[model samples]
Target: MATTTGEARAGTAQPASLQLPGIVLGVGLGGFVDGILLHQLLQWHHMLTSTNQDHIGVKYYNPKTVSGLEMNTVWDGIFHTVCWIAVLLGLAILYSRVTHSRRRVWTSRVLWGWVLVGWGLFNLVEGVLDHHILGIHHVYAGEGQVWWDIGFLVLGALLVAGGYLLQRSGRPFDPSAPTRREARRA
Candidate 1:
């Protein structure tokens, strides 16, 4: 028997376990972690912390003032809402893909690894945009804030590198491959 080109490609394709759900979860959960730890718990900054009186020209929120705090709180709520949606969307994608597939989809390392990549992507993008581009806020808003901001970028890079390595280590799922038990019986 000969395999068609489509079949050949399918046999070598990366597993779905490494894609949708993990990336979605990574972005959403990553956002939550940042928001919860930095914004709420540590009081490091808020969604619009640096927007007020800055070059952003919004002046919508200021962490130093009561009105600013209220505005920032609302923006934070909006950010959380977006993150929730990302999570829900990811779950939906994962469910749809898994349910429609004939192959077994376990919680593989590829999934976890891609998730870390997604998270790192989130961190890198968000950190660069909010902290550097828009000047919204820094990881730490006191003296030598640049150092903290740089650290955030470094962490993001590390996560991305680590995740990529982990993902690479995983073997692609071959639909035609025999299971260990099946092979043993042959």
Candidate 2:
């Protein structure tokens, strides 16, 4: 296909490496917001906690079985550390692949989709396992918490769908574009 001047300039001027790093950075920042602001800094809830129950009858269960399950700051810190690790990993992947001397290595659709899917998966899994099953935390214990969690999941699905559309829109990486050495070689 013949390249227009504008297209040529855009292709040549902007490097994929530069664009991808920001997206990865965004993922890290978002993770921080969730782990720090929502989970730890606010102390709104913990990853695991016994559900509140009201009972007038005498306790049937042994005290030892239930005593060890209380919320602790140490566990919260560990969860936050894991979140930071995930963000760093995402950043590393984006930096290595997108910033390499390759043309169109980072597609907008794919990158956005990745972020959405990843974020969504994190929420869905965490919600199901921690909030619903283990009773470690409720999906939204605080005001507007449920809405935020739902929004995160929905946004993730949308991103994945948007990425699929972008991929199908006949916008494959042009491996023969001479301006980029990697593209020219392919």
Measured against the true structure, the TM-scores of the candidates, in listed sequence, are 0.80, 0.52
* lDDT by residue for model 2 (70-118), tens: 3345466688777787678766766555434243544444355445545
TM-score for candidate 1, residues paired by index: 0.80
Winner by TM-score: 1
Residue 55, model 2: lDDT of 25
lDDT winner: 1
What's the lDDT of the predicted structure labeled candidate 2?
A: 0.50
**Model 1 weakest 10-residue run by lDDT:** 99-108
Residues 1-186 of candidate 1 have per-residue lDDT tens digits of 033435544774444554767788788988999989999999999988876534577665667789988889888899999889988987777666653222444545566677888789889999898888888778888798889989988988888889878766665543344566556787
The CA lDDT at 127 in model 2 is 56
Show model 2 residue runs off by greater than 4 Å. 1-31, 50-71, 98-107, 142-186
